[model samples]
Target: MKLDESALAATTNDLTREVDARGVADLIEFRMDQADDPLEQLAAYDGELPIIATNRARWFGGKASDTGRLDDLFSASRYDAVEFVDIELETVRAKEWLAHEFRENDVQLIISHHDFEETPDRDVLDAIIEQCAEFGDVAKVAVFPQNQGDTLTLLEAVNDATNRGIDVAGISMGEIGSHTRVIGHLYGSKLGYAPLLADDNDYAPGQIPLEKLASLIELTKNERVDGQVIDTIRSEVSVPKELTLSD
Candidate 1:
């Protein structure tokens, strides 16, 4: 559940199929919003991987449209199997008490922001990370990049956040930025997500199958045996401050 290390999560709405991801994924991202019976699925879950519950909202490119999305998310957090909960950055900014609710329950939170259209300016993305770090355990940003330039901007933003000592998860969605999913961890993204299978539903664009993503991680880990890429990024990026988790 540590936000400082790289972890891969398989995205799925079917809790029963999570067992297939046992070796491929470090965790399971239960997309509650996408399920027909989210709470029932959670209650019946008996899987090996810890769950990261996400009741995504329609505004954030998800199917959930009800007013009680947060209510459902909080309900899921009470489950012992759920180690983390993902809340949209907008929701956190709008609801002042949500952060406290999660903290009181001792549940780890991932404050997330998603740009389904296109990647924003590097500074804008950095600001989003700053806001996310102020509220949640891990600051997660996902943007749809149109080109390599956009993808680089997303990476730079993550680097900037990491330099500031913010625990972050950054990714550039869509095919143009697909490579970022595999390499973003090197630049300080702590988490990556992919579908359980290639034929299975993808929660986001450019998400590789869990099996393929695992292979890429292994390949990269071996190639970067000295961990020089991460070390170099840390050395070059200025650390203005360390992110302090709320007590």
Candidate 2:
């Protein structure tokens, strides 16, 4: 299923809940590296949210080893439910053949880069994003913020990309940069990831619980509307058990 970046941001659930609280996520990024049996879990998922699968390598802040990593990813892409798959640009750049495989499968690709240390200069950031965009539908960059300025740089990158008609998800890690998670959409970020639970450590650097993040995104979006903000009415919808892979 196709996804709306803003709407998806508002309806995300980090942890298991009795009801599917968050309406829909921009895209549910299932960190396959953390799942013991990712394929099995995907096969059994009864949620309405579309998935963006990632099996990151340890070298790139993921637990999965190099061996079998691509194989597992290829298997997951075949699932009807997965809308996109996050693949590191480094990997695609080295193995150009992998990009061809993704294209043949008709899977939407997110070329991603994670910098745990510090943000880079605007020129450097532009170069990285440009390179990644050449290989995927969207380009994502996450950087560790050393100060508030770093966060501004991230926003600038997002804005620049958006103006260029490029879909980008740019985030700055660390406390001061946390606000970027909410404001990212304003700058044309196509995806925002937050855990279902506050303490869930699935992602590194910066993360807020799904509920809190959803609330914030809603408020921000509402504030942008010219009229008075009204309480968002909740809807009752059953979660689907399986998602069919599509072209």
Candidate 3:
């Protein structure tokens, strides 16, 4: 199914789990780097879900090496099931022409950035999203947040870019930042990646169980929070405490 806007994708290295992921996941993130004969699997795929193909390289906290990486992703782009393909922002910036190559295949490109160490300050984060937006159909970033404050920084950056009409997605990794997985969309993250099954190993840190995430997404959508409130939370001090009134 084609997404009009944002999507909640089930992340998997195995395509066989697609059937199990149907009810909760809106799309499949086929991890080429972690799977065996990924192209072969894609060729044989009969699943109903559209795919967001990813072949994450090792330097960016994944298993795949750099050898022939772009070639394989380009090949993945040819498959009918692939609606989107993810490539690193660094790679795209250096090669420059690769974005044109992917779009020519009729698939959107999601230019991604990963900060395994720490979340950068807000200005840098916004800059990263802007840079990704300039070349990609969507700008995606994943950062390791040391505290809740860092998650807010990421959400603000995402919201700032999104409010500018840029399609963007962001996630904060590790325990302290897991809450971002559920709420980042409310702040303008255009994609949510959770495992196909609760028991499946997470491709990234702090991923909630798929079913739980779906439920929370449902629950959170009803909140009466406004854009101005979120902007206030980001800018002014004690916003959270002030909002926390006594029942």
Best by TM-score: 1
Q: TM-scores across all candidates?
A: 0.88, 0.83, 0.88
Worst 10-residue stretch by lDDT in candidate 3?
A: 236-245
List per-candidate RMSD values in Å. Answer: 9.9, 14.2, 6.3
- Misplaced by over 4 Å in model 2 are 1-4, 7-24, 224-247
C-alpha lDDT (0 to 100) for residue 43 of candidate 1: 97
C-alpha lDDT values of all predictions:
0.89, 0.77, 0.88
Candidate 3 backbone clash number: 0
Candidate 3 lDDT score relative to the true structure: 0.88
lDDT per residue, candidate 1, 1-247, as tens digits? 6755789999998999987999888899999988879999999999999999999988998888768888898999999899999999999899969999977766799999999998988878888999998999899999998788999999999887888899999999999988999999899889999888843666898888889888997788786466788899989978559866577
lDDT of 2 at 68: 94
Candidate 2 worst ten-residue window by lDDT: 9-18
> With candidate 3 superimposed using the best TM-score fit, by how many Å does residue 245's alpha carbon deviate from the native?
21
Pairs of residues clashing in candidate 3: none
If the candidates were sorted by their TM-score against the true structure, best first, what order would they fall in?
A: 1, 3, 2
